[model samples]
Target: MNSGIGPMVKSQSSIPLYAIILILCLIAIIGGYFLSKKYPLNTNELKAIFEKEDGESNDITEPSGDIGNSYAAIDSSGVESGEHGHYATPLSQVNKHNIDEVFHVAGELVDYDTADQVCKQYGARLASYDELLHAYQHGAEWCNYGWSQNQTAYYPTQKKTWERLQYGKTELEKTMCGVPGLNGGRFKKNMKFNVNCFGKRPDKPDTDFVHPKLPKKPTKEQSKEELKHFDDLVVIPYNRKRWSRKDYEPHPV
Candidate 1:
């Protein structure tokens, strides 16, 4: 029953298992080297990939310092652009008449016409009723009422809503007497109100980049000097002699 051809056929078909494994290892090494060269990985990227493979979130890792600093720089620039975020300051704190779109001019109460002219001189328009409300919501405080758009007037009070309620008045009732229950009160056109103007700050070239009006960042030495002469730097109120009140309270509508 034995056939001599059967043994010959079995011998020809047999191949070494070690040789097959060695060939496959070479192919894998060559492919991996080319892939790594084509798409290089950063430390963070590698870490993210490994973490993802391990069933963890890549967000667990914090951004590097350089990335964080870049974000900080963007935020600083956004403030100059008057973007509605952390950089927007209260109108009271705005010293420049038109530094960042919305700014106020503290002057003797002037009629609506005069306020319009004053704002015009600075290439700005009087803040509208909504604009005034926005400033109030953003924490602007001035005892002297300001001329708002559409022949209206507005001012911010330090009293919180609850405090006003305790005084038998609601904040809305106290805020906009002109609208009856809304935001602003109608005032005589001839009466004077401080002017708050809204517009874009002019852009100027800085080195190679164009930038809006920017407050200079003081150095360590400049900070010390400024702190030493803080009082000298502050301008006294124009009507301080006539208006002896240091804390200006909101007047009744």
Candidate 2:
């Protein structure tokens, strides 16, 4: 009897080619994984791999109309505070033509109608009560009270005293006017308070800005002449006798 080694060799040779190929592939994959640990792919390498596989361009562009750096710092009620003072936000958020521009006319008391006119002169309107409250909430400084568009009077106070009755009770915070409520009620329309103004941006950029010629600033000589003229003006109800040095004398304490 022949001890048949040839029969066993023939049986192994009969195994499928695909089986051999699969076993070789598994070995290659394990070796590749270990090799990858030694030589890890970087960002550029990974990106190149993705580009090659996806067949896509690498020139990525940021989408247009994004807010980007053009942030409108105004609050919900359309108000912004700046180095100059608080100002009403422009109607258009896209173009902040005057967002930080100090456009308000304060420091002088004026009636409601006069305040309106003052704002009109500056191409603005008196800011409404809602608008003022919005500014106040956005950390606007309030001083000496002012008139709102609705012909009411108010001075901005700390957040949520009586105006924003947060806890079903009115809490007083340290502000000028003592007790708290947003509405100073309706003042006599003629009664004066400094005005806060609101302006709207033009629908488009003011390309025709040159049409309405802006006044030139006074030269040094012109300013001196004007100053001299103003100083030369005499103010009198002919009260020379009444306005004597004696009038300014302090009384005995």
Candidate 3:
């Protein structure tokens, strides 16, 4: 029946198959091109884009010219800056403010005026020498106070410190060089002393400071060592508690 037309029909079927193959090949090529470009552009292009965008930004500007030349720091140099702490002192407990507690937790401040002011902002403060020592112990034991009965850890000793509750001041001594509580001379008339805590160490300078209207206490020759030691006074950490006999079991006086 057909003749030449039948053969052409068969050829047309093969043409459709070839067309499908070509379409698939094109799609694969296109997919590969996109897949290869998935990563971000190279550094040069990124730098260019960044520079272009940065050039458009204008907010606060840096200081210019002579304005920088006239600037100076008003603060006096060589004074204590931040909270004082021991070598074993962990940063988490340092508060340059008041220690409000009676028993002196590691960070309690002894004064409300200076140290306490800074610490109250964050609910922390300077620790008393003993408290500071305890805090140092906490640091050595990773702040774990439980099961701590070691004498070496409970006392100051830079020579010995381990995973125990050692409160020795060897490390603390180096860190708390001239701090008020650490290197204090002795207790004064108004000073509240904890004989139980600080042993019999006088908490204030043995001699008295001269008030313009008041009389002087001791001359350098009278107690020269104490006067010399006074110069070494550094800011010592302390607790804010004013202990009375009632506060302690046997009376803390």
Best by lDDT: 1
TM-score of every candidate relative to the true structure: 0.33, 0.35, 0.17
Give a tens-digit lDDT track for model 2, residues 121-219.
Answer: 556677777766565554443434567667776655444332222322123322333333243657888788766665633223222111111123457
Give the per-residue lDDT of model 3 (tens digit) for 125-230. 3334555344333221111111111111111221222211122235642333222112233332333221111111112222222211111234557665544434
lDDT of 3: 0.30
Tell me, by TM-score, which candidate is best: 2
Tens digits of lDDT, candidate 1, 84-159: 2222233334244233344455535689878887677656788786665554454443334667788887654333
After superposing all C-alphas onto the true structure, candidate 2 shows an RMSD in angstroms of 23.4
Supply candidate 1's per-residue lDDT for 76. Answer: 21
Clashing pairs in 2: none
**2 versus 3: better TM-score goes to:** 2
In candidate 1, which residue ranges exceed 4 Å CA deviation? 1-99, 158-184, 200-253
- Cα RMSD for candidates in order: 20.6, 23.4, 22.4
Q: What is the C-alpha local distance difference test score of each model?
A: 0.50, 0.49, 0.30
